[model samples]
Target chain A: AQSVTQLDSHVSVSEGTPVLLRCNYSSSYSPSLFWYVQHPNKGLQLLLKYTSAATLVKGINGFEAEFKKSETSFHLTKPSAHMSDAAEYFCVVSDLTGGANNLFFGTGTRLTVIP
Target chain B: GAGVSQSPSNKVTEKGKDVELRCDPISGHTALYWYRQRLGQGLEFLIYFQGNSAPDKSGLPSDRFSAERTGESVSTLTIQRTQQEDSAVYLCASRPGGGDNQPQHFGDGTRLSIL
Candidate 1:
C-alpha cells in the first residue's frame, strides 16, 4: 500500500520569504517521490523527484525537496517565494512499490503569495 | 520531444450522456496513464497502459469508465452514462519506457462538465 499526505491544504507567504510545503508518505518499499505544480488552466509540471538518488533533489524554478527516509517525508522548499509561485502543488508517490507509471497523489497544497 | 496532446479541451455534457476523450502520447513513450482531478480534489488515478499488454484498470472509479490503447501510440478513455459527480479535468500522461526518472509528460487536459 502507498499513500501521500499533504499536511497543509493552503500556505500563504509574502513575496521573497521562504516557502515550505510538507508531505509524508507510507510505502512498504523504497518509494519514488515527486512534486508537481499546476497553475490555473495549465497541465502539471514536474518540480522534482526522489528515486533513491541523492536525498536532496533540486528542480526547476529554484524549488527543491529532501527525501528523508526515517521521517517518511519529502517536503518541498524554496529559499524564497516569488509571486509566480502562487499555484497548487501536489506530492506524489509511485504505487509501483518499485516499478513504474502508477502514482498516488497528495490532496494538494495551494500556495498564495502576497505582495 | 513534443508533449502529450489531448483533444476537445473542453466538454459539456448532459447527465446520462456519454463522452470520449482522446490522447496522443510522445513518440517513444511506452507507458500511458489517465487521471481525474475534481474542482477541489487531488488527482485520482484512472487507468494505465504499458506497451501492448493489458491495461491496469485498478484505479478506475467504476465500470462506467473504460479505456483503450492501440499499439503504443494513442489512447482513448470512454465514460458511459456520465453523472454530475463525474465532471472533472481528465489528464493523460506518458513516460519513457520504465525508467525511474521518466517524468510523466502531461497533456493540457479536457475539462468535462456534466449538466
Candidate 2:
C-alpha cells in the first residue's frame, strides 16, 4: 500500500517570506511524487513532480521541492511567498500495487498568505 | 477544449436521488481519472480509465459509485441513491497514456450537494 502524510493542516506566511510545506510517504515501490495546488473555486494545478531523475525539482511560480529518499520526505518550498500563493496544497504518490496506477494523496495543507 | 472539462458545476438534490456527472478529457489523452473531495479533505480516487483496458475501479467507495468512459473521450460518473456523505466536489482528471510519470490535468469539478 502507498500513502502520503502532510505534516501541516494549515500554514500561514507573510508576503516576501519563505514558505515550507512538509510531506512524508510510504510506498512499496519507487514512487512518483507530485505537488498540486487548488485555489478557492478552482481546479487543481500541478506545481511540481519528482520521477527519480532529480532530487531537487523546481516548479512553476517560484516553488520547488526536494525528494529525500533517506528521510522519506518531499517538502515543498518557496523562497518568497506571494499573496497569490494562498491555496490548498496536496502531496500525492502513485500506487501500482494492485496493477492499477492510481494516486494516493495526503490530507492537504491550507496555506494562508498575509499581506 | 485544451483542458479537461466537467459539467454541471453545481448540483443540489434530495437524498435517494441518482446523479450523473460528466467529464470530457483533452484531445489525444487516453487516461482519465475521477476523484472526490470532501469539504476540507484531500482528493479520494474514485476510478480510472486507460484506453480500452478494464478500468481500475478499486477506488470506488461502494457499489453505488459507478463510472464509464467511451474510447478515450468522454466519461461519466453515476452515484446511485445519493446520501449526505456523498456531498462533495467530484473532480475529473486526464493525462496522456503510456506512462505513469505524466501529471494529470484536472477539471474545475462539480459540486454535488445532497439534501
Candidate 3:
C-alpha cells in the first residue's frame, strides 16, 4: 500500500520569488512519485514524476522536484515564480508492485502568486 | 481534437437522479482513467482500464458509481442515486500504449452539479 501527504493546503508567493511545495510519501515497495497541477475548472496536468531514475526531476513550466529517500520527501521547487504559475498542486505516490497503477493523491496545495 | 475529450461539459441534476458522463480518449491510446475532483481538493482516482484487463475499481468512492469501456474507445461513468457529494468535476485521461513512461493526456472535464 502507498499514501501521499502534502504539507500545506495553501502557499502564497510573490511573482519572481522562489516557490516550494512539500510532500511526504510511504510505500511498502519501490514507489513512483508525481506532481500535477490544475487550473480553475480544468483537468489536471502532469508536472513531473520520479520513478527511481533520478533524484532531480524537471518538469514543464519551470517546475522541478527532488526525491530524497532518507527523508521520504519529494518537494517541488521553482527558482522563480510566474503569475501563470498560480494554480493547485498535488503530490502523488504509487506502489510499483501494486496490482493497479492508480496513483494516490494528496489533498493538494493551492498556489497563489501575488504580482 | 488532439487531446482527450469529454461530453456534456456541464451538468446539473437533482439529488437521487441518475447521471451519465462520457469520455472519449485519444485515438490509439490503450489505457484510460477516470478521476474526481471536489471543490478545493485534489484529484481522486476512480477507475482505470487497460486493454482487455479487468478494470481497477478500488478507488471508486462507492458502489453507486460504475463505468464501462467499449472496444478501447469511449467510456461512460454512471452515478445512480446521485448525492450532493457526488457533485464535482469528473476528469478523464488516456495514455498511449501502457505503463507509466508516457504521461497521460487529460480532457477538460465534466462539471457535475447536484441541486
Best by lDDT: 2
- Interface RMSD computed for candidate 3 is what? 2.1
- Fnat of each prediction, in sequence: 0.48, 0.66, 0.48
Q: Give the number of the best model, judged by DockQ.
A: 2
Q: Report the C-alpha lDDT of model 1 over A6-34, residue by residue, as the tens digit.
A: 99999999999999999999988777889
> Every model's Cα RMSD, please?
1.6, 1.5, 1.8
The 10 consecutive residues of candidate 3 chain B with the worst lDDT sum are B95-104
**For every model in order, what is the iRMS?**
2.3, 1.5, 2.1
Candidate 2: give the clashing pairs. none
Q: Score chain A of each prediction against the true chain A by TM-score and list the results.
A: 0.95, 0.96, 0.95
lDDT ranking from best candidate downward: 2, 1, 3
Minimum summed lDDT over a 10-residue window in model 1 chain B is located at: B96-105
lDDT of 1 at B92: 95
> In terms of TM-score, how similar is model 1 to the real structure?
0.94
**lDDT for each residue of candidate 3 in B19-114, tens digit (9 for 90 to 100):** 999999999999899999888777788999998989999889999999999979999999999999999999999988555446678899999999
Residue A92, model 1, lDDT: 85
Model 3, first chain, TM-score of 0.95
DockQ for each numbered candidate: 0.57, 0.69, 0.58
Clashes of each: 0, 0, 0
